[model samples]
Structure formats: C-alpha cells, structure tokens
Target: MEEKLSKEKIVQAAFQLLRENPELEKLSMRKVAQKLNIQAPAIYWHVENKQALLQSMAEEIENHFVAPKPKENWKETIYAYMENYYELYQQYPCAIEIEIQTIPSYPSRLRNLDAILGILNEAGFSIELSYMTITSLQHLLFGMLMDSSEEKKLYNKVMAGDDYLKKQIILMKQYVQEHELKNISESIQYRQKEKQKDFFMKTLRVFLNGLDTFV
Candidate 1:
C-alpha cells in the first residue's frame, strides 16, 4: 500500500527541496510533488497553493525551535534566545526568506514571542517598550542573516574569479581611503578584523545595554 500523505509529509518534502536548492523562487507545489512522487493536484488538495505551502514550511521551521529557558537576568535570556534563533536560521537554506514571507500566526512563533515579552515585562519594561525591543531585535537578526546570505553568494562568485566584483571592491576601498573618510574606513577595518558572530554579539550587547538604561 502507498504511504499516507499528511501535511507533515508535504512540509518535510518541501524542506528537502529547499535543502537541495536554496533559491526561494524555484520552490513550487509541482516541485514538491515531484519530490514526494505525487501529482501536483494532490498537493493543492492539502496546501491550497504555493503561498500556503510557504506558510506551512515557515511553521515547520518554527516547530523545531527550542526556546531558551527563562533566566533571572533578562538580558542573558534575550541574548541566549537571539543566539539560538540565529543558529536555527543558519541551519536551513532560505530560512530567513521563508520567515520574511510568512506571517507569525503559528503556535511556536507566538509562544516564543510571548516568552520574550514576558521576560521584558519582568525586567520592568512597559508593554510598549517590550514590543519595541522585540521588534528591534528581530529586525537586527533578520537583517544580519539576509545580508550574510547575500554576501556569501557574492563572495563565492568572487572566489570563482568574478573579476568585475573584484575590481569594484578594490575601487570602493580606494574611494574610501582617497576620500579620507576616517570613521567609515576604521569601521570597515574593525569589522573585517573580528569574526562575524563576535561582531554581532558585541552589537547585540550594545543594544541591550542601551535598553538597560531605560529599565
């Protein structure tokens, strides 16, 4: 007998397709059906359409997230949560894109958001402040991952001898130096000197420290 097809199976198949090809544009119900050895019409019966499939895929990713246990120090808890969240996004190809495209209606996403808000509330932040904090942190995390992903792709092309990009990089560096833009030059050099994770954590700490003053 053929194995049963559930939403779970369909979502898993879609994840596999993403793993094999990280480009979000290439993902489709037809491709997922091909991966699962099913007809495209069958996928529509369960998922309705590509947007719905993406929503399912986004929820599936959230389901895997294990939120950090609450700590007495709210900053510590928030830091841990952000770090774990970063790693989770890094684990899946096109994960950040999937998250950006979907609404956070899933249980896991809501639970995690609630947990963060609770932590901030306990830390003496007003509801407005707590919401703003979470929103800012998410923007930082999502923006970082999106930039990193695109940067890696560009770097790969450079590694493959993309002479045009190489020349552009050199020219940009030269422009900065020739223009005597001390702050920008120093910042670029500083970033290049540290590992990306270290830089991100340092920035996160700075943000949290600023928020601490408000608390």
Candidate 2:
C-alpha cells in the first residue's frame, strides 16, 4: 500500500521546490511530482490545482514576513516591517512574484495592515493620512524589494561600473536637446536621477515633517 501523505508534507515539498527553482514558469505538476517522487495526480489530492498550490505558497511566505514583534515606536515598527519584507523577498523572489500576481485575502497581510494602522493612529495621524501613508510605504518597499530581488547582481554590476547609466543619460540628454524636446527628456531624466538620490528616505522624511499638521 502507498504511504499516506499529510498536507503539511505537501506544502513543505512545495516550499523546497520553490527554493530550488529560479523561475516559476518552469513549475508544473510534473515537476512537482518529480520533486516529491509522487505522481502528478497525488499533488492534486493536496492542492486543488497549480493556482491553489501557488496561493498556499504565497500565504506561507507572507506569514513568515509579517509576524508581530515588540516595537516601541511607530517609525521603528514601520522600518522593521519594511526591512523584514525586503529580506524575505530577497530570499524568495518567487514569493514576491506570486504575491504581485495574486490578490490574497490572507490573514498575514490583514494583520500587518491592522498593526500599521494602529501605529499610525497612536502617532496622531488622521485615518486618511494613516491609510495613505501605509499604502505609500508599501509601494516604496515593494518597488525596492522587487527591483533588488529581480536583478541584485546586475544592479550591483551596473552600479560598480564606471557610470554607464550616467553616460547613457548624458547621451540621451544631448539627443533630446538637439531635437528640441529637452523638456520632456529632462523630466524623464530628472525622475531617473531622483531614484538614485534615495527618494524613499526623502519621502519618509517629508511625510514625518507633515505629521504634526495631521495631528
């Protein structure tokens, strides 16, 4: 008789598969089966389908990232959450992709949001400001984490090189100037340069400056 398998075991297997593979496009029932040494049909017995499997994996990852910890200050709480999220995405880039692709009604996300909302309230920010601030923070961190996770080595390589991006920007600006579209190109160039200036830190600083007005 075949040995009975538990759902936890199946999820564990899925986690192993996710960690081993760099790309999810190559993930399939057959591949999962091969990893577990079980038939593809056996996987369906644990997860309804591939989407269900991916969803479960995403939930597991979110759980790992959003756990509560003792934080005395709102800024520390928010920064701690963002730092953990960045680290989590760095380790499991696949989970970040899965999270972006799916709209999860998971408890992990809800709990984290609730905690953030509470922290903002305690800091005397209005409900609207609190909601918008949390949303903005999530967007900034998500963008950074995704960008870093997807191309960490490539980004480091580019940054380490002798100003390749800067050289391209200068070339583009010259072309734009000669074409009499300097304003449009300048706006694009300005935004790209702004990113290099640690805009996330600047945005948070500005938001904090306005916190007193909100209170």
Candidate 3:
C-alpha cells in the first residue's frame, strides 16, 4: 500500500521553495511536488489549490508564535508582544510574504489577536479601540516588513539602468551627481540595510506615545 501524502509534507516543500525564492508570485504547486519527490496530483490531495497551500503555509508560520504571559502592566504586554512577533517572522522572512496576500484563517492567528484584544481592553481601551489597536499593529508590521522587499525590487529594476525608462534614469543620475549623493541604486540598497536595523521597538514607542493622548 502507498503512504498517503500529508499536508505537513506539502507545506514544508512549499516553504523550502519560498526560502529559495521569496517572491510568492513565482511559486507554483508543480514546483513544490518536484521538491517533495512526489507527483503534483499528490499535492492536490493535500491542498485544493495554491491558495489552500498558502493558507496551510501561513498556519504553520503563525503556529510558531508563543505569546508572553500577561504582565500586570499592559504596556509591558504590548511591548513583549511586538518583540516576540518581530523575532518570530525574522526567522521566516517568507512568512511575511505569505501574510501579505490574505489574512490566514488560522486558529493561531485568531487566538493571538484575541489575546491582544483582551490585553488592550484590560489596558483601559474601549472595545472598538482595542480592535483598532490590534489592527494597527498588524498593518504597521506588514508595511514595515514589505518595505525591505519593495526596496529590493526597486534596486533590481534600477540595475537594468539602460532599460529603466532612459530619460528618468539619466535625470536621476544627473541629480545625484549634482548633489554629490549616492546613486539611486545605492540609495535603495542603503534603505534595504536600514530596514534591517532595529526599527520595531522605536516604531512601537512612537505609536504608543500617540495612544497616550488618543486613548
């Protein structure tokens, strides 16, 4: 008798593919099967389609998070949450890409959201405010993580300098030279590095500070 293919195996294969190529747009089910030493039809038995494969991958990633125990202080809880969240995704950069397309209907994500909502409410936020707080942090993280990928894309595009709408490239090069600035490609590369710098803590501080007056 043949062993049945498992969803975990399929997701692991897809995740390995993602590690090699973070561009989610380029990922395909057939490629995942090749990685797994299985037929593409075998993958279909596990995941109905690519979206389902993504949802399973997302669930695997979200399930890694171990939320901190509630400290008496809500601010501390919030800080701890963001710190843990950032570190978790840092290990799986492709997980960030998985989350960008659609929010996974995974229990882990929903549980984490519920816990955070409860924390915000306990911290004196109104129900609506608590919901908003969780949502705001989610979006902030999404944008922050996406920024690095975006800068890389721009850098890749500009590397084809001659192909990049010749007039704009020439003008940009002239402006940089005139101002003694780094080339646009270099600027984008620098921003990519800057994105890796410690940013989540500082950003959370600023956001919470704003909450001081608003909440």
Per-model CA lDDT versus the true structure: 0.89, 0.71, 0.80
Assess every candidate by TM-score.
0.91, 0.67, 0.81
TM-score for candidate 1, residues paired by index? 0.91
Winner of 1 and 3 under lDDT: 1
Tens digits of per-residue lDDT, candidate 2, 1-215, equal 97677566676676678677657777776777787788888777888877787777778777777554857877667666666676676666476678777667788877877877888888888888888887787777677656656665456556788487658757877888889896797687776678532565566556555665656
Each candidate's root-mean-square deviation in Å? 1.8, 6.0, 4.0
lDDT of 1 by residue, 1-215 (tens): 98888889999888888888778989988899999998888877788888898898889888889888876799999999999898888788899999999999989999989888988898899988998999899999999889988998899899999999999999999999999999999999887898878878888999999997799
The 10 consecutive residues of candidate 2 with the worst lDDT sum are 195-204
CA lDDT for candidate 1: 0.89
Candidate 2 or 1, higher lDDT: 1
- Candidate 3 stretches with Cα past 4 Å from truth are 1-4, 156-197
